[model samples]
Target: MEREILLLGNPQLYEISEDVKKEELEDLRPVFEDMFDCIKGIRRDYGFGRAIAAPQIGIKKRLICILTDKPYVIINPTLEFIGDEMMELMDDCMSFPKLLVRVHRYRHCILRYTDENWEKQEMRMDDDMSELIQHEYDHLDGILATMRAIDNKSFVMKKYANPSLSK
Candidate 1:
């Protein structure tokens, strides 16, 4: 299934996701697979997308699949360590589809998640990769980088000023 990329300025982009169960993960796998294929198809056309969320694909679930290719499937994901030591990065989202915004993010993150095998694990992310993880995780919660910009009073450039930001 070639899932169309959800663009920025879409109201569905801000709809928070629901928690997922172990069984739901099984049901969502095909969707996730299609999303991966879609993202892969877009990769060369688009640029870097280390991660993407279910909401970004127009499904509101607490689900995200990250391709560290070590890959991770996080259900009911959340962010912590939102403190001063964090880095303020300029980021864009596949869900937002476009619009780059300078937003604050943790320099490092300890993510506790359930892998594809239904095993529970915790992993850490730092630097640009950390930013990528946080960006996608926010999508799981239906929050876009632009919303972060609105909260942080950061500026969001109009679309395709950074074309790579598009889904």
Candidate 2:
């Protein structure tokens, strides 16, 4: 089933998500599958979206699925090693439609998560990949890009401060 991604102004995007518990494992798997498919479908059509979270799809769970070289699931991820270096990128969403926004995010980060098979894993991410992880992680924590989204006009003003800016 294709899940509908919640829009930027949706309240769910800003609410902190609850961790997945033991009993909900079975339920979350299919939900994860749906999210995966939804993200893939959107990315395939739009040529955008590296990651997506449950909240973005209106699931309100602490689950996020990212499509990297090896697309994988991250359940109740814990973020660390948030770097001082930042990157601003032009980002659009299935939820946000045609509006592109500039978002500031860490240039490097470390993440710990449970894989689809329930194996615990830790990974270091940098550049756009790091930004993608943080982006979806924000959705897992109920934050939307709009909260940090810069005005299209002001994007240039902030660009000099962060040369890695995008869009």
Candidate 3:
């Protein structure tokens, strides 16, 4: 099958991705390039996109690429939610563009992961950063924002959300 964006109905998106080994990093360089291109293209076409998980592109590997001021490459990432605080917001995904799902995420979190250079890295995130990383982390475990909707009425089209987030 062609390795392209896996949409909402793609079974591959629901499968739990495997952890990528450090030894595999070099070989996955091409995959990284494709992921950057994919996320950038989506952001360009849809007006919003911060990151993309490997499963979104039909690759069942625990990897995510965040394109902000610079690129953030997270491999085998794990999240640690801080405190008992939660923030509710509308979440969007590359897998299902323009379909927003309202969900609750931790207000603060610590993300630990392997970087592109194979170095250990951690980021203490709050607000938008926390929400963005949490959204991508969920994709590693076969979870989607749609599955975490607060209620049946939490779904909305991109244009309908009064104040859309860059999720």
Candidate 4:
């Protein structure tokens, strides 16, 4: 199932997603499959992508698929900011692949979520992992990276921000 990722201006992208019910955990396999495939497509065409959220694929569920050395399915995640420290960086999204937004994100966080078997799990994330999780977590709450932009000057065309993207 190749699902089209909802674009930035889509109204549905603004709607908050619903939490996945414990009983529905078994049914998320295909959704995870589609999300993993979606991120692969994004990487193949756009050159960079690490994860995808259910909302990006119009699933309206609190789920995120992280595709790195291995795949991780985050279900109904909650984040606890570790401190006041923040880092500003250019963030991109599958919803608006060609755009980049300069935003500040917490440098560390405690991510708590339910795994595939519905067991509670937690991870202390920092650096890139922290930013990546925050990005996808925003999607579940009807938020986009653009909404977190530092200022009007925070937005830029991706090609200009990343020289490699110009290729």
Candidate 5:
């Protein structure tokens, strides 16, 4: 089932997500399925959405579905390392597609997460993947990119923020 991505005012988006237990991972197939469906739906509508956290769909679980060259699931993700280098970029979320927030994110990081089978895995990611994972991880911690905005001037409507980009 395709789940609705909770909007900015939705309380579920602000609630801290619970970590999924190893035993319960298998039972969460439906939630994972729905997350992937939600991401697909968002991309279809917005033309750009690489990942989505469980909380965005009101699941309140520490899970994120990412689509790159292929689809993958990350359960109970943790940032194992953050590089000293930082980069500023306009970040958008599925919850607020019309808004873009300028935020700073690590240029590189090491992330550890569990797969669908509960096996532990770690990967080193460069700026793009690191930023994407950080954004999704913040969602798991009840943190929105809007909250991480560099300043008052950092937030802007997507249309006004990037005129060159298609709506």
Candidate 6:
């Protein structure tokens, strides 16, 4: 099933998501399936979504689906390390596709997460992948890119924003 991507005004987007227990992994397979479907649908409609957190679909679980070189599910993810280097980028979210926020993010990070089958895994990511994971991780913590904006001048409507700022 393809779930509806919750919008900015939705209060659920502001609430912290609960961590999914390893035992619940099997039961949440359907939610994972729906997340992937939702992401694909969003990419088809908007042309620019690489990942989505469970909260984006009204699922208050610490889960995220990322579409990178390969699609994969991450459950109970944690940022093990964030590099000192920072980069500023205009970030957009599935929840607020029409708005872009200029935010600072780590240039690299080490993330530890559990796979769909509850196997533990870790990956070091840099550049786009690092930014993407950090964005999704914020959703798990009830933080929006808008909240991380540099300042009042750091936001703009997608159409009015700089073309180079597309992320």
Maximum-lDDT candidate: 4
TM-score of 1: 0.82
RMSD of each: 3.5, 6.2, 4.0, 2.1, 2.7, 3.6
Candidate lDDT values, in order: 0.72, 0.75, 0.88, 0.92, 0.89, 0.88
Per-residue lDDT of 11-47 in model 3, one digit per residue for the tens? 8888999999989999988888888988767766677
Better of 1 and 4 by TM-score: 4
Q: Could you tell me the TM-score of candidate 2?
A: 0.83
- For model 5, the superposed segments whose C-alpha errors exceed 4 Å read 160-167
Decreasing TM-score order of the candidates: 4, 5, 6, 3, 2, 1
Candidate 4 colliding pairs: none
Best by TM-score: 4
Deviation (Å) of 155 in candidate 6: 1.1
Q: Model 2: runs farther than 4 Å from truth?
A: 150-167
Residue-wise C-alpha lDDT for candidate 6, range 29-140, written one tens digit per residue? 9988898898888776666788999999888999999987888899999995564999999999989888889999999999999998788999998988899999999999
lDDT of 5 by residue, 49-94 (tens): 8899999988889999998888889999999556489999999999
Tell me the tens digit of each residue's lDDT in model 4 across 19-82: 9999888788889999999998888778889999998988999999999989999999999999
Model 6 Cα RMSD, Å?
3.6
What tens-digit string does per-residue lDDT give for candidate 2 at 1-167?
77877776777777888888767888787887788788777665555666788887777778888876777888889889564888879765566755666887888899999877778999999987787788788777666666677764523222222234334
Q: What is the TM-score of each candidate against the true structure?
A: 0.82, 0.83, 0.92, 0.94, 0.92, 0.92
